[model samples]
Target: MTWLILISASLNALLGLTLLLLWRIERRHAYVRMWGWSWILLSVGLTLGVALAEPGLVGLRYDLQALVASFSLMGSLSLQVAGARDYRGLPRGRGRGLPVFIAMMVVIVALAGIDQRFAVIAGASFLVVGAWLCAWWMGRGGDGGERFVALCFVAIGLVHASGPILDPFSRSPITHTLGLYVQMVLSLGLLLLSVRRAHAEARRQAERFEQLAHVSLQGLAVIQQHKLIYANPAAMTMFGLRDEAHVGRLDLQATIPPELQEEARERHRRVLADPAARIEWEGTRLTTDQRRLYVRSLSSHLPWDDAPAELLVMIDDSSRQKAVDALRRQALHDELTDLPNRNFAVERLRELTGHGAAPFALISADLDRFQLVNETLGHEVGDALLRAIARRLCRQLPPQAMLTRLGEDQFLVLIEETRDRAGAQAVAEQMMALLETPFAVGGTELYVHLSAGIALFPQDAADGPGLLRAADSAMHRAKGRAGAAYIFFDSAMNGATRTRLEIEQALGRAIAAREFLLEYQPKFAAGSRKLVGFEALVRWERPGLGRVPPVDFIPAAERTGQIKALGELILELAARQLRGWLQRFGRLLPVAVNVSPLQFEDAGFSARLLAGLQAQGLPHEAMEIEITETAAIGHLGRVLPQLAHLKSAGVHCALDDFGTGQSSLTMLRQLPIATVKLDRSMIDPLPEAQAAAVVSATCALGRSLGLQIVAEGVETETQARAAEALGCTQLQGYLLGRPLSAEAAGELLAGALSAV
Candidate 1:
């Protein structure tokens, strides 16, 4: 019996150490630590019982041995119950059970002092209850390992319960041997349960990872040893693979383009060498079906099957790249002509003028009379004509030159390596010569002309904008010439440009100050020399400048859009003067006011003019609107409607500067006019046979149309007589009367009425 007790103590000690080792490996299993302490306490209790049985062998007090053995047995049972509760995830009830356990230990110690047999029975009762509780807790909803542990505890409780019944006075070898076997079985069951739970958790985690990879949109793949080991659904579709089997057979290097294979190998080496490496790149790849794809991919290191591997995520970027390229082109190129636009020209100029650059020339070209084509033949034909012109210019350009459209009717050319003014001039001339030929547009043979200006680097101006301005100014100067021409920029043009700008600015102030006045030039009958009507002319006198010539300011006013306001002022003064004359003399002579072409483009011009005349309480016939032949012919579509409206309202309309325009016969026939004022050029050469014949033929044409012919610029009596003999009904020049002030004209009108 003593040997059995020693062997059971050793076995319990071994089981306790094994459980403690398992607990150290997995600290989260705190119930294993509690169970290990319970086994250690049971081993000490068995050892104490052996010493109490033979005090001579251990040389210890019998009473002390019996008391410690009783306490150890109770402590071991309490711990078993607590550990069972912990394993079942239930509260240990330490606060309620602690006093009860102390009372049980006190009763057992008191019982041992009376008789050792009573103490042993008391301790065995506690073992029976605690072991039964463990069995019930462990077996409830338990697996195979937990059920086996419950059975072992149940057998242990029965063996200890019968030990006190069978031999209450001595130790039982059979009972101790059975307890050792039960404890060993419990430890094996615990180890089995822990391993099974770990395997189950691992399986659940793997399933979650598989589901996430299958549903991901980004292409995901794993490459090991330069061969495809794993591929998700997205990766298989991206590479045009039929199934997972297809992906498994493919080599990673085979999917890459031949030119990019070396790059891929280098990247793979980097990923394997450093576990934290992440590489991002863009390249082309070949699909399984031999289709090329533009892809952006991210590569990073991944551990797969306990070995280093590469993980790649890819995105198709073909469409996005193409869209970006298309947007860039639209921003820099002209939509209509498909050429580089002004923005592109400016950017190129900036690049060329950076730090140190070779000398280049900028040529500005403007199409002459392009507006006339648009107004006459329709804008469709005009657009066609511009396209034709662009194509011709491109064909004529040298390989080193670039042409860009600077908006409507304007183009810019850049020539590199231009050495001097002559080089620029030659290029401009060559470009201009390409337009001398007629272009067939919309079934019409249209002749086009170009006016070009040349500005050189380090010669005309310094920077891009300055060069552009210089070229534009020179172009305007060339446009002022008689025919198609090209000119180089000079310093004098800048002064002229500045002066024009000053005039434009001052004109705004003059209009506000009302510093403008009207002068009337009297018209007379060719035969009777009788006063007929007057032509009201606008004249400006700045307070400090005294007077600005009409030629200098009129063109500026028209160009700067100041003519509209000036025209309104002239209408108001003329209407007021006519009203004053009618009140004083009880008669009124018609006054002709000149209108600019731009003013007629206003949709409300006729309505505004009629309203003004009516407001002044004057008849419509008291105001005759005069338009130049060039204005009437160039903007015939816009001028014709206004003329027709005024003619219907009983207001007279006359074509001024008639013979200087291109189509005199067309204007006479199409325009609703009451008179035709011959230009000074036609009358200047009058009385000459050829000039006389031309004037005579014009007068006959006018008379046949029931129109009055007024010959202008008749300086001498011979010219006046020649005009009268040539079937002229009216004459207006210095010979008849000079332009007079409002006061002088009013006195002259009163004198004429008194004479009548």
Candidate 2:
């Protein structure tokens, strides 16, 4: 047991010496070095003092070792407490009082162990003070690793206080060996924690410096009074300053040329007063011995100490200002035409309207089917057309005519001091005629029509915004009428426009009022006279309005975005009727519904339709939808995808009014449609041989493309016979069946089924 105790104590003493050497190397890290040095001394002192007390070195030398051990423990404990508390703030002074207390306690303990008379009273005093310090740390809300350190302190105090009574226990070899091991391990753990914390703090400071350097865009330099102390890499290149020694002695004023010295000083003072504000200064710099630089520097001050400050400066060469000016010009003008854009147009209008003068007329013009021109000839040609139109209009305009391009296909012309209503009307006609002239774009002759709306100054509108609005409204009215004619803004036109807007708003509310109903038109097989399918047409039976024509309300609904909700409502009604028909007829005939162009634009249209069908528990194949060629061609790319998605989901797509569309048969073939319905006009004069040949040709084309051809608008047996001769397998019109209500259509199908 004695041998084991000696071996353990000796090993601990060696470790303590190594730690003391490491502490000397890292003395600059005060918290870590202090704790580490204290641990190393404690370990060595405890090992030697405990070993010597076992009765070999019997007197003052042994007492001195015990004294050294006590002082080391006290020093190490106090440092551990301070390092833990250092999270709040670093502690000051050497902490000499703790060491003094431990030294007096150690002397008293040595005397008590030697059986001195006053030893007991002195030991009691020392023990009370040590215990008070441990309790004091505990009372200050000690927990975590810090609480463990405090507990070790309390244990150490109790051990020393019980020294006289525990003479027998202290003499035991097992107790001394175990006690020495525990003390060495505790000191090493506490010292390692302190070292970790110091390293972490060093890393945090480095990170803060890195963040500051990253965030600053301007060149930064720290100067001490008149001399530069440090310059960041940006500062070095910005001012063309040399190395650190040059920066250390360089005066900032030396960088500015003599002529600009006063301006530089004024800007510098402003920066010093407000570090956040940018201060501009122009000065010449010497690029080399012979070359001189004319530089403009935007600078700000970053003060580090009260004695001196640093300046963060951004330098731009004056020669590059041309590029900056180009960017500013591009922002205000249209890039395609290099003309003053909509932003500039609005400003020009405001400036023109500011003057109180005679009548001036504002004319707003839009190119008819301009989108079609772009689609057919390409955007390059479209731009060339616009530029040519702008040049032609410029040539025709009087000196007072202010022409501004408003949008992609719209332009605004402000003519000041127009000759009353007749003169204003004549100017608008001339402008329209000039716009209609052929534009030679990329060697292609393009004919474009212009719709112009004239709003007279001080009468039609009193202000710029109002004048623009009136012109825009009148332009719509002009386009609504036939041909290339210009219309003056009038109150009657405004009333009609307001009525359309009111109708659009009313159509939105009609869907929720149960005013919408399904009117079904039955499809016959022509040969068997059996009902094959029913076309689902929507009718709005408003409470006071009675039955509204599909033409009037449908177009209005489509234009005003009431179409999507209306389409969904119609689909739900059709699906419900189909389900009921299937329940009664014992077999389901596909229901054909119509979809508007705007409805197809929604990305979620396919998913919503499929989910609605699934919710109704009806198979998707039981429904077929008709899309107009106008709608399909309006957004070909988006519509093609939407059609493909519907086809993939087992729904049928039919192109309605096939030949009436501008899209050729080749374009139609590219679409994934299962059927094509010949327009009503084709069947109107169907008995005529020329019309029959056209129908036959269409039917042959449909057959070649594997598309089912349904001939619509068959009015008589002669028309039906002609359609049959043309190989039309399905015929639907007033001849076979008119559009019927849900119940009437159901009864018609039932009667037809009975006949079959």
TM-score of each: 0.62, 0.47
Q: Cα deviation of 117 in candidate 2 (Å)?
A: 99
432-474: candidate 2 lDDT, tens digit per residue: 7786668788887888898889898878877788888889999
Clashes of 2: 0
List candidate 1 stretches off by more than 4 Å: 1-128, 140-143, 158-181, 211-219, 224-227, 243-249, 253-285, 292-301, 312-534, 539-569, 581-590, 596-623, 630-653, 663-675, 683-756
Supply the global lDDT for candidate 2.
0.71
What would the per-residue lDDT of candidate 1 be over residues 148-189, giving only the tens digit for each residue? 889988988888887787677436666777777876777677
The worst-scoring run of ten residues by lDDT in candidate 1 lies at: 51-60
